[model samples]
Target: MPATLLIPLYRDEVAPRFDLAGEALLVHLDADGAELSRSSVLLAHASSEELCRIALEEKVRVVICNGIDDEFWQYLRWKRIEVIDNVMGPVDEAIARFRADALRPGDILFHRSDA
Candidate 1:
């Protein structure tokens, strides 16, 4: 069966904090990891509880975000939802890394230029 993934968004990048995220990107992937569909979810407000509820309601198999509180992290883990936290980058880059199985906790995918 295909799997579903969620990534909280802040503009075009991953949200810096999961609890404060007001939008999310939902992606569906097939067994071989090819993207099946993608969509954006706009939340009425920023709330960890609401995000978690959405994850559950959508049957999300994985969540990728920048920072997440231990409470919510543990809750998702307890519910068997895989979380790849501490990821910082453009949503497209993060999704590509995830699809390639290269995304990991604490990954910083942003490019830095020396001034």
Candidate 2:
């Protein structure tokens, strides 16, 4: 099964916000990770509640987001959905970290503005 990525729509590195749900949900069958279109990320419009619900319904194994609200994070944790917080990178790089085991469930990755 492919790992799923949940991203914010408005951020530079995040996938583009498209569709009524407003987020790019990349589901690829590569353990190494897959590249996604910047125009297809639509996470900005969806609230934490909505995203959490989406993750659950989609059976998303992983979520890489710019930031996470406390309530949403807690909910996701309860659901056993791994979250990579404060992630800053291209979609592929983040997924690489996950595949390499360099990224942890509650990791606080830094996406520098300079990067």
Candidate 3:
């Protein structure tokens, strides 16, 4: 079966911090790089515990988020969920890079104001 990815969202972009996000996006992608579906979930609040619960409940295989707490990061990894952390970009671009096997930890696909 194809894998599912969970991404915390902030205004159509990857949330800057996982624990601070109040919204989430779940993406289902097939092995052939086709997007099966995409949906947004409004979180009850910004809580890592709640987020982890959803991930587990949804059987998410991968998580793409920006900043994440060390403890929570370790916890997800321990649960066998692959986390691609520190990804700063629009949701579509991020997923594209992931599908191409080009996305990496700390990937910044959005325009950098510092440039």
Candidate 4:
């Protein structure tokens, strides 16, 4: 099946904390792992439960964020969503690494945005 990746977003970068993010980037990757579409969603509020609900509602298959709480992490995993946490960088770069299968938890791909 094709997979959808959700990334908690803060401004132009990955949100530092998942539960605190008020917006998210939803990326749909085709069966071949090419991007099918990308959308940004603004939430009514930020919370772990809200994030989970949105993910489930959107049928997201993967989640990539900078930091996530343990309970939320476990919950997402339990729901069968692949969670790649602690990744820090510009949203585009992170997604690039993800598509290339080079993204890992705690990876800081971009050191500066002004470069």
- Sorted on TM-score, best first, the list reads 1, 3, 4, 2
Cα lDDT computed for each candidate against the true fold = 0.95, 0.58, 0.93, 0.91
Candidate 1 lDDT over 2-115, as tens digits, reads: 789999999999999999999999999999999999999999999899899999999999999999999999999999999999999999999999999999999989997962
Name the runs in model 4 displaced over 4 angstroms: 112-115
> Which candidate ranks first by TM-score, i.e. highest?
1
lDDT of 3 by residue, 47-109 (tens): 888889999999999999999999999999999999999999998899899888898999989
Q: Give RMSD (Å) of candidate 2 vs. truth.
A: 5.2
Q: Please give the range of 10 consecutive residues that has the lowest summed lDDT in model 1.
A: 106-115
Off by over 4 Å in 3: none
TM-score of 2: 0.62
Per-residue C-alpha lDDT of model 2 across residues 1-115, encoded as one tens digit per residue: 4566665444445432212235555554355454432224355465667777777876777777656666777778789987677665565556567667686544434467785
Model 2, residue 56: displacement in angstroms? 1.1
RMSD of 3: 1.3
TM-score of model 4 (CA atoms): 0.93
lDDT of 4 by residue, 35-108 (tens): 99999989898887888998999999999998899999999999999999999889999989988889898998
The residue ranges of model 2 lying beyond 4 angstroms of the native Cα positions read 15-21, 30-44, 104-115
